[model samples]
Target: MPNAMTKTTSLAQRLLRYGLYAILLVMAFVYLMPLWVMLLTSLKDVEEIRTGTLLSLPGSLNFDAWGKAWGSACTGGTCEGISPYLMNSFMIVIPAVVISTLLGALNGYVIAMWRFRGSELFFGLLLIGCFIPFQVVLLPMARTLSFFGLANTTTGLVMVHVVYGVAFTTLFFRNFYIALPKELISAARLDGAGFFRIFWRIVLPLSTPIIVVTVIWQFTQIWNDFLFGVVFSGFDTQPVTVALNNLVNTSFGGKQYNVDMAAALIAAAPTLLVYVFAGKYFVRGLTAGAVKG
Candidate 1:
């Protein structure tokens, strides 16, 4: 009787475990349903899409949608497709991420280690800037960019993005660094290491996790930014997000559902790929720095 009761308990536990696993699997499917639909839509022909059963197999697998999104899709008279704007997206997002993350690391280190007079105020001002909406600053930022002859260009978009990103990036790194031990930094300084030396050798090397965190966050933010890209960039310098907005908003001949889905997916592809590939690093970075801090 005792053995039978134990067996029953064990079986019940196994059943619960299986139930939880099934629930989680269903949740994951729900989350990924849109992507699955989009992929199928991208593969389908216009006729199949018009039939509007998103789960159905494509009557014919069409790479043409991919081709059109990448090139030959019309945005007005231009047929350059999403390729040029996709390049422009990279041109801006990469530089913006690199420069801003680098500068943010510098700012965070100085505030954490140095902590001199007005440094608090400086950080406070940055904090305040983070609260201010980008829209409120748009006119001033555009004016500033125009003053620097960078308005309506890729360079200008990068500059604005970096400026906006700096405040948030500084916040991330500052939180992380404050959690770290002071001794490692203090000892290096006591040994007559200059600011640059300590940062370059001790602090920066240890910042790998925070760096990855910032990179992933900043890269995604900059890549998906449509407002700044549209406002700061001219037609020639606009990113894929803007082109995608155009593609969705303006349709001719017929509403090309397959084409629109393909374009949207194309616009999101890089960030999605980056997240999938870098997700491990992102998780590692968060815990490593936080534990040390």
Candidate 2:
């Protein structure tokens, strides 16, 4: 009787496990459907696109659309394609990520380890920036940029991203640092290490996990920012997202769905690559300090 009951329990657990797997599989399929469609559509010719349903596989692999999207398809008034705009996005993202991450680390180190009068209040005020909507700051930012002779420039865009991204980066670093052993900082000071010296020798070296998280977060956010790119960038300095929008809107003779799909993929490739490579690190970083404070 005991053996029969044990077999019955085992069967029930197996059924439950199978049910969960089925549900997850369905969810995964739903989420990946659009990407599958985009990839299929991008590889097909215009004729195939017009004739085939979204799920239909292309008869033959064609890369003409990808080439055109990269170098020749018209974006707005220029036929230069999204190549230059892609470079512009990289220019903005790299500097913004570096500056924001460094500033965040410094701010976090001070707030977390170097307690001072009113530091909590200062950190609170800084946290407000994280909650502020990008739309709310548009007018003020435009005016400030214009005043500083940076309006519609790539450098201005970089500065804007750096300022906005620092809050979140600071939050990540502060939380991570707060969970660290204070003895480390104290021991370093006892050893005659100054602020920057201690940070460089100890804290910063141990910051790899949080840094990966911050970099992935900032790179994804800055790289994928469309509204800020469009609003802050000049014609010549437009990012790939803006150029992709223009490419779709400015089609001359006919709407080329394949080219549009390919351009969209090109614009998204950077963030996708970042995630593909470092996504596990991102998850690990988020959980690194979870067990402590």
Query: Which structure among the candidates has the greatest TM-score?
Result: 2
- Give the CA lDDT, 0 to 100, for residue 138 in model 1: 88
Q: Write the per-residue lDDT of candidate 1 for residues 1-293, one digit (tens) a residue.
A: 99999999999999999999999999999999999999999998888888769799887789899898788787655777788889999999899999999999999999888889998898999889679887898899989999999989888998999999999888878878887789998898789999999989988888889999999999999999888888888979988988888877776789887888888898898999999999999999878763343
Q: Report the Cα lDDT for candidate 2.
A: 0.93
Name model 2 segments beyond 4 Å from true: 290-292
Estimate TM-scores for all models. Answer: 0.93, 0.97
C-alpha lDDT of all candidate models, in order: 0.88, 0.93
Candidate 1 residues lying further than 4 Å off, grouped into runs, are 1-9, 290-293
| Model 2 poorest ten-residue lDDT run | 284-293
Where is the poorest 10-residue window by lDDT in model 1?
Answer: 284-293
